[model samples]
Target: MKRTMLAVAGALLLGACATPSTEVGIALFNDTVQPLMVTGNTGTKVGRACAKNYLGLVITGDMSVEAAKKDGKITQVASVNKEVKGYALYAEVCTVVTGR
Candidate 1:
């Protein structure tokens, strides 16, 4: 019985740490206008962007957006792709920005 309880606790802990991630499946832009300068692709990992409590409450922030823009060095956003990683206890989201 003790061993079973310990096993369950371990499983719960691992589950809480497991992060489920996803990305935007669709394109961000439809216009055909070409950019004068094409910047290289860039990605940034942002954490604490969201969180879930034991009661299923959620909170979010703009850290991911700011980080992505800074990393990409983008002034004018032409297109954007977003990837989200979520955990039972915490969450991390990444933004992939492209274009000039």
Candidate 2:
């Protein structure tokens, strides 16, 4: 009976140890875009790259620029195709740092 109790406790502990994918997903998104050039990259490029990398790390859901915009997840608006898109997004993200 003691062994059974111990096993149950261990199982519960192990189960609780399972990593939470939600936080990881958000972190993954933050990490992917955090290091990029927030000034040089266009908004579209930033949006696409950020979404691709962030969503790519996860096992589910679409990560396109349109999807991001649709979901209102992109705090900055990027161009649809021009390099300016990425640059715009970068500018938005780096406003505090660049003051441009």
Candidate 3:
């Protein structure tokens, strides 16, 4: 009975200490968008950018839309995409800007 009580207490402690995480993992979708042309046979390009999340509260780093566009050498954006990869206590929010 004592062992069972200890186990239950341990479980409760661990559960209480656990941090809530949201939107963890890769997401191949856009959070924002603009009107742009995506044509076939055109040269495809991709730009990547990342932002860091601290303690699930503070966010630091650069994941600018313009930066992604520049990285892909895109004058006129065809489409914008995003990817989010994260783990316990930290996260990396990334953006993939695609263009022709």
Candidate 4:
């Protein structure tokens, strides 16, 4: 009984430290783009803000629409997108924003 309990706990903890994935499906190396939102107008300006993870240990970045908007110098938000590229050990998550 103790062995079974230990095994279950170990399995749960094993995935707890796994790196984040960008793809919706299960893949070791995933690079995917997902649409977040769309307004009536698709603005002319475009910007992207990214955050990165290291070995699933350290993660840092401003992956926010506001950051993207600031990067693009946008006033009104017309659309938003999310992009992810993950390689088991490292990962990059980005927010893409478009506006006027």
Candidate 5:
């Protein structure tokens, strides 16, 4: 019973702690999302690129501004956005770009 109680307490603490992507393995969940305006000029094309994380071991995909621009077939970037979400042993990050 003591072990069980201690485990529960530890889990609670871990889950309650703020987790950054660099230390995601220690937390139960994490999330970070935001929008960014790169330039005042607006564009009509939109593109997105994403990367996935598994057990914090393997990460695959291209979550870069250049990748997003390429995916959208854009030459000029006007805005950018980023999103991150993680749960348990899995996480994903994505980048969104808008350009002309």
Candidate 6:
């Protein structure tokens, strides 16, 4: 019974600590995935290129890449907008991604 109670409490604590993605990740996700999600890119290359650019942005942020990766902050990669250019998002994303 004690063990079960501890497990439940632990799960609840961890769940409560969950936070939203950083501004940079959110922006990148929106820009890169938005176009593809809305109309489906004409070619795979276009879609891949978009993703690559966004990823590049994340890698060049002010934070250390290792820290961001460690914090699981990059998971927002899939939650982007469905109809946006994402270049501005990319520049900011780069700083966050790299910096983190």
Best by lDDT: 4
- TM-scores of the models, in the order given: 0.39, 0.23, 0.54, 0.77, 0.68, 0.23
Sorting all predicted structures by lDDT, with the top scorer first, yields 4, 5, 3, 1, 6, 2
Q: Which 10-residue window in model 3 sums to the lowest lDDT?
A: 25-34
lDDT of 3 by residue, 1-100 (tens): 9999998876554433233333442322213333333544344788767787645567776888788877788766656566655454455666677776
Model 4 spans > 4 angstroms off = 1-18
- After superposing candidate 2, which stretches have Cα over 4 Å from the reference? 19-100
Over the stretch 10-59, how does candidate 4's per-residue lDDT look in tens digits?
64444344446444664546788899999998699999999987756788
Model 5 lDDT, residue 75, Cα: 94
Tell me how far the alpha carbon of residue 56 in candidate 4 is from the true structure, in angstroms, after superposition. Answer: 0.4
Model 5 per-residue lDDT at 4? 100
Which regions of candidate 5 deviate over 4 angstroms? 1-27
Across residues 9-99, which tens digit of lDDT does each residue of candidate 2 receive?
7655443323222323422112122321244424432333222111122322354445545544455553333111121112111111111
C-alpha lDDT score of every prediction, in listed order: 0.43, 0.31, 0.58, 0.81, 0.76, 0.32
Model 5: per-residue lDDT, tens digit, 1-100?
9999998876555544323354334346767766866898789999999988765557788999899999999998889988777676567778989989
Candidate 6 deviant stretches above 4 angstroms: 19-100
lDDT of 4: 0.81
Worst 10 residues of 1 by lDDT: 26-35
Kindly list the per-residue Cα lDDT of model 6 for residues 1-100, writing each as its tens digit.
Answer: 9999998876544432231144345332243322212232222111111122332323322333334434444422331232223432232322122111
Residue 17 displacement in candidate 3 (angstroms): 12
| C-alpha RMSD for every candidate | 10.4, 12.7, 7.6, 5.7, 4.7, 14.5
Q: Summing lDDT over every window of 10 consecutive residues in candidate 5, give the lowest-scoring window.
A: 15-24
